[model samples]
Target: MIKWVAAFLGYFLFRFPGAVLGFIVGTFLDNFGGSGNKASSVFQDYTRQSVSPADFELNLLSLCSIIIKADGQVNQRELDYVRQYFLSTYGKEKANAIFRTFNEVIKKREVSAQRICAFMEQRTRYEVRLQLLHFLFGIAQSDGQVSKAEVEKLIEIAGYLRVGRNDFESIKAMFIEAADNAYKILEINKNATDDEVKKAYRTMAKKYHPDRVVTENEAIRKGAEEKFKEVQKAYETIQKERGIS
Candidate 1:
């Protein structure tokens, strides 16, 4: 929408110097609070403050790419996970911009992880860094397990974030334990029957039922959902592998 308006106004003001001024003013006002609309001020302010020195879009892409690399294979499922996350959180236009930035970041083989880590360390808040680490861990464990590569990079990023090694180990263990429990809940193993799968799903469905969690404690709902998804994925993987009916 902004781009369309900018293009139209730019075309209209092609010739005169005043036209350039008008376009600039108009674009700025449109983005800010033009036409007596101060609605976007808070959001704009937050974005400006959050992304001043380090480009937020570029940084996010770099972090996500590193996470994808962590899994060793960089599968379509992980790529899809990234795309869906950006689309849901940042909207399609910004998501496209970030993905383009990610492509550029991936091209530079000479880029230094340490320098990038330094930039992120200096720029973002501790809370935001923790959220990012959780997100990366969630992505790595999305397919019901975490690869060694994923574990390695998780540790690397945790160190860069200045999270203590002990803390990092604890967090990693927590998520991995959660993931393993999810797999167990689904009865994923070398031998499992169709009845066992159905029974396990029923048991987990009752255990992780969102209505129960939301009613009991809203705080646990999100974690429950993630855990449940892993259970489902493990079930699917086992079923596919064993050719279960």
Candidate 2:
């Protein structure tokens, strides 16, 4: 059990900064316990745990710091959006702690978005990665518009994470309002027939629905819900435009 825990910690130690690794190790240890046969069982359990919500939260904040700083300046609106998101998801005390870590991460000159995204791809599930992309769009649009630089950075990070073009465009359209936003959000061509539009909408709705996220964490679930709502809004916009029932 100790060997497994040490190996896991070592993996993070190599990939993440000391402070983030410390927090992750602490969280894992806090959840760890048992003796003899029980200890072996616990080790097996821990090995199967994959990535916990705490792990996801820490990585998310770290990546967020990188995205916010992508444009060479971290705007107040972007920071405020992140704070409110943390507070809503983690409560005031935990949010403050994570926010402190985020600030610390951004101050370091060595942590790049490419490294972080690669690390996240190794640890996170597909749904969580999608949510991370969605969150980045939220951060980029916090100042009421997504800049070209932010879009480029997002594409770069998504590429590192191996997020598909269709999935990435689906999330992008949710934030960027334009005449063809509905088609982009559904990942369909603008020339689709009404039946094709309906099919696309159903497919996207199923893909982005909050229930599709296989996590018990309410925060993560809520983030998925927001994406699900965006999918719904896109479908509705297309329906209205085409006068489809």
Candidate 3:
């Protein structure tokens, strides 16, 4: 872990300058694309992140919001990702505000990556930062799809968080890759028969089983509740698709 942390810090420092430049360019393009429109609102929100004072977790939340908005539209997959995270990490009031502010900000016209990074540098604790990076990767993987752009952006955020390459990859596998086949919740595939579907559900339920996770990490157990629900949902979807009651 110490080695991973050290590698993470080095990577971030190395990539810091380029990321700042890219953020500036991205913000400018967002503004130029829509001088005065709803899209412009997103740009405005993106740029103003500079002035807002936030703690590490909040800063991470803001950054995730930006990345989620990057592909042009926010869908249920991303929403489920964010909602699961906030519900797990914070109380209802704080979670509500975090979600609300995230929605409100991304609607603006411009953003300053330099300012955002400065906030992260000053405010984020190393562990919390790493966790947030992991969460963004989870969001990116929700649809079982990763674009070149999204992967690059996630790497950028990992660099900013000073997360080591190995640790970041672990995060990718744990959160992103694990959650990738979520659309499977819509139907069981040809390779999977009725018995296979039941078997998959049993496996997932055991894996995300809240009781098991709670025994391991009381802090994250409640958060696992939402994930466990997804497992159950998938099982139900498979049953419905197969007409197996």
Highest lDDT scorer: 2
lDDT, model 3, position 18: 50
Model 2's lDDT to the true fold?
A: 0.77
Candidate 1: what lDDT?
A: 0.59
The lDDT of model 3 is 0.56
lDDT of 2 by residue, 1-245 (tens): 44456556766676445445655665566566432333233223222335545566667777788778888897999999988987997789988988888888778775677877776787556776788788888999999999998999899989998999999988888888777987898899999999999998888888777766765555566779999888888889888888999
TM-score of each: 0.50, 0.77, 0.46
Task: Name the better of 2 and 3 by lDDT.
Answer: 2
1-245: candidate 1 lDDT, tens digit per residue:
45446556666767455456656766776665532233322223222123332254466567777777655456678778777776776679977877787777756554555676777677554434544565677778766788888898888888888765543543454368654443454544335567877787777566544444321111123444555565566667656766766
TM-score of 1: 0.50
Candidate 3 per-residue C-alpha lDDT over 103-173 given as tens digits, one digit per residue, 9 for 90 to 100 = 76667655554466666654433443444564566677776676667778777767766776755654454
**Higher-lDDT candidate among 1 and 3?**
1
State how far residue 59 of model 2 sits from its true place (Å). Answer: 1.6
